[model samples]
Target: MSNEDIYLCIIGLCIVSYIPRVAPFLLLGKRQMPHAFELWLKYVPTSVFGALIFCSIFQTDSGVDFSFSNISMLAAIPVLAVAAKTHSLPYSIIVGLAAYWGLQQVM
Candidate 1:
């Protein structure tokens, strides 16, 4: 293809990709958000965290192995319990990471 044609193709691709991302906010405009939608939005964080934790805990280099040697998974149990009990982000992260490190050192 000619240089001009390639440039036009790139411009077209950019516009196509940008429309899906930008169109939603532009179309939503000043409309009031519905109650159900607002309620659903509240659960997004929890759902995202649960998915992330599940991915991290169960995923391994070779394959899915739920053996006793999974130190990170083991340490996360207490970390999750502490987080649920105290509702503290910093403390939970610190304790979880430290516990993982300690466990790794000993094993």
Candidate 2:
């Protein structure tokens, strides 16, 4: 593709990506959410996190595996403990990564 064409493509991609992200804040900035909806929204992050962790630990390329050999399931134990005790996302993530890497090295 020509340089001008590539530039236009890049600009178009940026606009497309930016609009969906910015549109929510622009639309909701001045609005007051309902109490019930606000309460439900609070669980969204935890629910999403649980879903992602579930998929990562339980699912594999060959299919679902609940065996002891699953590194993600092994790593999740101490990660959950650290998260529960410290209640810090950053620390939990760091511990989880370290646990996963260590498990990889040992196994």
Candidate 3:
């Protein structure tokens, strides 16, 4: 295919994708969701967070190397512990990032 054809196809797909995602929110403004669906939505945050934490912990550049070399992961331990114990996102993030920066400097 020509460059023009590919560009047109991508634009068409993007427009198609945007309609389904945007249309419902635009048309149905703050409508009540079913109780069951609302309850299910409550789990989404934890599930997404768990997935992110799992990916961050298990994934690496070369392979599975859960070492102090990974400053983010190292910082995440204290972050998770403090967040869990205190239930404070702002404090956890601030302390975690500071620890990460400190570790990066040392390494």
lDDT of 1 by residue, 12-98 (tens): 999999996886697677676788977997899899999999879877997775887998788898899999999999989999999
* Residue pairs whose backbone atoms clash in candidate 2: none
Candidate 3 shows a clash count of 0
Clashing pairs for model 3 are: none
Provide the overall lDDT of each model, using Cα atoms, as 2-decimal numbers: 0.88, 0.92, 0.83
| Tens-place lDDT digits, model 3, residues 1-107 | 99999999999999999996996688676676678977997899899999998788667878776776776678788888889899998998888888888888998
Instruction: Count clashing residue pairs per candidate.
Output: 0, 0, 0
Highest lDDT, which number?
A: 2
Candidates 2 and 3, the one with greater TM-score: 2
Q: Look at candidate 1 and tell me the lDDT of residue 61.
A: 94
Q: Estimate each model's TM-score.
A: 0.66, 0.66, 0.58
RMSD of each: 7.3, 4.8, 5.5
Task: Arrange candidates, best lDDT first.
Answer: 2, 1, 3
- Per-residue accuracy of model 2 over 6-106 as CA lDDT, tens digit each: 99999999999999699668878687668897799789989998999899888989899899898988999999999989999999999999999999999
